[model samples]
Target: MTTDPQVVALPMGDLTFPADGAIFPGQTVVVVAYAVRHAGGVFLFDTGFREAAPGDDPELREYFQKYALRTRSLPDVLAAAGVDLGEITAVANCHLHFDHSGQNALFPGVPIYVQPAELAAVREPDYTLPEVYDFEGARFEQVAGDHEVAPGIRIFATPGHSPGHQSLVVETPDGPVLLAGQAVYTRGEWAGIPGALVGSSDTRPGADQAGYARSVARLKALNPRRVLFGHDRQGWPD
Candidate 1:
C-alpha cells in the first residue's frame, strides 16, 4: 500500500447527446473510466454505460437511443486494460449517473464507494438507473466527503453536476493524477476557456453552479501533474 498507484484510462464508448444534453446539440462524446493499480490492488473510478436492452424503461431506452449510447462489456474492457475483475479491490464512482455507474452491478461484494447524497439522489424517481447501483449483491460504502479509499488513492467531493459527485486523486510517482468525473466536461473548461462545454452544471436542471465553480477552483488549486476527465478523451497538458 505504500507504493503509488498507476492510473490508466479505459475507453468505454461514445455517445451523441441531444440538443438538451451536456455538450452542444448533436455533439458526440467519448465516455471513459480509470483503473488505478497500486500495491494493495486495483481501484476503479466510474463504470461506464451499459448496453441498452429491450427491458429497460421505455423512457430510459428512448433516452439512450436518442443519445446514441454505445458501450462495451465492462469485463472485456477491464481485461483489455490488463486488469482482471478479481483483482479489483474496490470501486468508487464519481457519481451515480447512467453513464457513470451502469456496470456497477458487475462487481458484486466489492466495496463500491459513493457519497451519501448521491445515493439519495438515485431515489428521485428518474434520477438514474436504480438497478445499476442497488441490485442484489451490490455493496455500497457511503462516504460523506473526502476520504482515502486505498493507499495513495483518495476521492474528494466535487459536487455540482450531481449532489454527491466526487473526483479521484491518485498520488503517483510522477505527480498527482486527477480522475475528474464530469467535474469539468473537457480540457477547455479546465483551462477556463470561454464558450467551452461546462458539462451538466450549466445545463442540468437544478444544477448548483456556485458549488460547481467552487469545486473546480479547488481542483485547480491542487495543480495535478495530469488531469483526466470523465467524458474528454484527451488529458490536460497534451
Candidate 2:
C-alpha cells in the first residue's frame, strides 16, 4: 500500500482588531502554517512567528502584540504532525515577512524558495528592516515566475502582498488547492469585495495591482476546489 502526499495545516496564532475590511474579526484572525509531504520529504510552506523579543519597529511590535503572533517553533509543529525536522527537504515562503520567515533558521541545509524581487526589496536600505527578510542560514532559490517544486505542487508568482509575493497551488485529491498566501485576505474579501489585497505598501516598493488582478483571475480560472487565505477563513465552492 502506498500513501499519497499530505498537506497539513498547523495552527499557529491569531490576529485581533484587524484593520477595517481585513479578513478576520477583531478576535478571529487565525494564522496557520502548512506542511506538505512528498516522496522526497516534507516541505513546509511558511514558518509561523517566533517566540523571540520584539524588534525596533513600534508599529510592527504593536502589530505583533495585537495579533498575538507568539507560537511554537516550526520544529515543534512538525513533531506534533509526526514529522521530523531532518526529514524536511525544503522551505518555501510566499514572502519574507517576519511572521512567515521566523523559523527559517531551524532548517539550515534546506533550500528556501523565494521571489527574486522580494529578496531585492528586502535588501534596499529603505526596506532594511530585519523583519523583511530572515536569511540567517538559508539556501535560497530565487524565482522570477512560476515553477514546480514538487511532484504535484506548483508555485505561481502573485506579487501583490509584496513585491515578489507568490502563491502555491497543489493538485489535491479533490482538485487544485490554492494556498493564497496574502494575495487575497479571505474568501469574503476575494468574493465579497472588489480589489481586496493584503499588502499595499508605499514605503519599499509597490506591487503591480494590475498584475495582481490578472493573477487572481487566473487562479479563479483554475477553479481550485479550496482556496486557503493567509490569515482568514478558507473558501469552498458551493
lDDT of 2: 0.71
* Predicted model with the maximum lDDT: 1
> What are the per-residue Cα lDDT tens digits for candidate 1 across 1-238?
3566888788999888797755378878888999999888999998998877667778777877887888888889999999998898999988888888888888889999999999898788757767656678988999998999877789989989888999999887778889888988898888777876776446566467888988898898888998999989888976
TM-score of 1: 0.93
Q: How many residue pairs clash per model? A: 0, 1
TM-scores for every candidate against the unseen true structure: 0.93, 0.80
lDDT of 2 at 144: 86
List, residue by residue over 26-51, the lDDT tens digit for candidate 2. 54556677888877778788887666
State residue 206's C-alpha deviation in candidate 2, in Å: 2.7
Clash pairs detected, candidate 1: none
Which regions in candidate 1 have their CA more than 4 angstroms from the true location? 20-23
The local distance difference test score of each candidate is: 0.85, 0.71
